[model samples]
Target: MSASETTSRRQVGWGIVLMLGASVCYALMGVSVKIAGRDLPLLTLLLGRSAMLVVASFLLLKFRGSPARPGNPRLILGRSATGFVAMGFYYYAITQIPLANAVTLQFMSPLFVAFFSAKLLGERVGTTLLLCIVLAGIGATLVVAPDLSTFGGDSLFALAAAVLAGVAYVMVRELRKTDTPETIVFNFAVFSLVFSSPAVFLLDRVPTPVEFAALVGTGLFAFGGQILMTYSYRLLEVAFASVFSYSTVLFSALFGFVALGEQPTLLAALGAALIVGTGVIVSVAERVPPAP
Candidate 1:
């Protein structure tokens, strides 16, 4: 093998490592959100998380010598808006439902992403993609079915989060044409902070020391995960990196079981398998060249 091929393999190996670390960070973030949400209001949690992100994003931009302003304000705002709303629903779902269930449901964003890209981006939806979507739908239904009896509309909140996340991701794909990742993240942080600030004033409650730590952990973990995942994609193909992204669901399941004593029912576990497995198939399939 050529030296270049050896270097390429090394890069891919490191990328996988970074992606796995990001997944763990994200799973821990979910765990922190679950813990903090037990004592804090959703808005309050959002406010705290957004506030930290704003500060962190600003520092990152400064460190990178990048401008804080977005190159395309319209797309930035759209992505941020959708992401903010999706985050709200996701956090709420984490509090109301099992951590793995909420994570798996939100992980359905890829299925929705495929649909939205075809509709909004004028991308083609091939037969393989359609099959993956159908299987993912069944998986999501199974995950939601078990939660419905106890959590009521909470499970739907996760699904809403997934839908909005799909829109936000599509917007991000478009925004990448003009904006730097730092700029996009900085804009999102500022947007989330400005919009979620109302929660701080509206919900006047003091957090205990434990809750405060958990709130801080939520932002820290999320920021770390975002940065790691972004860097991983820089080293590897998006499709390849995204397959490891599904590892977040597994980490969430393990963390949920260990930290929260939350165990998925047999059906939910099966659903998670379907979603994760179908997601892997879709990611790999998207990257494969069509046979002539």
Candidate 2:
């Protein structure tokens, strides 16, 4: 095989490993938060998590000596805004929805990313990839559809969270086009901290030693998840990396069952499969070059 082909295969291998590790750790974060909820209020725990992320990301950046790249300040600020909002929904959604379900819907963000990319970045959408998106959306809807009736109040919030995450994912595509990963992550933590501070002031109580430990545990898992995610993105195409990313849902489902006693139904399993399958197809299809 040519060098390029060899590199592509290696990238895929790395992507698989990174996605699996990241996904499992991310699922654990969800489970941890659920456990922490037993004693702490949602807002209080969220603020604590945000604070931890800020500290962890800052130390990470400092350790690596990551310097911010010069870019459009407007775009950076926009991303920073959305990033904070996205995490708001993310934390809230997990609290409301089953861990597996919330995570599965979030993974569908790449479909929105590709769609937005075509609109915002003017990237061409091949027919195959378009179909893949449709399939993925259908799968995601299927997974969450049953909860619509029983989960009325939560349904809207989860949908909103999923949509917000999609927007954040799309924005990241643009941000990465002009910035480094460390820069993006660093700014994400900064803005998340800034945005969460007010809520922290109003909602947070000083955590006990055990409560403090739970916060640290969740933050560490999230930090590892982010690191694995960033490393996967660096190793593989985001499109390709997205396929492996579905592994997060798989992991989350397991964690939900263990942590929250939210066992998967047959339909939910099937839905997860279809959604993740569609994502894989989208990734591989996007790999194909357009016909001249």
Q: Determine which window of 10 residues in candidate 2 has minimal summed lDDT.
A: 283-292
- Candidate 1 segments whose C-alpha is farther than 4 A from its true place: 1-21, 122-148, 229-244, 264-292
Ten contiguous residues minimizing lDDT sum, candidate 1: 283-292
**lDDT to native, each model:** 0.76, 0.66
lDDT for 51 (candidate 1): 83
TM-score of 2: 0.82
User: Compared with the true structure, what per-residue lDDT tens digits does model 1 show for residues 22-56?
Assistant: 88998999999999999788988888888888889
| Top model number, lDDT | 1
Candidate 2, clashing residue pairs?
none
Residues 171-216, model 2: lDDT tens digits: 6656665766567776776776676667555654677787678778
The model with the greatest TM-score is: 2
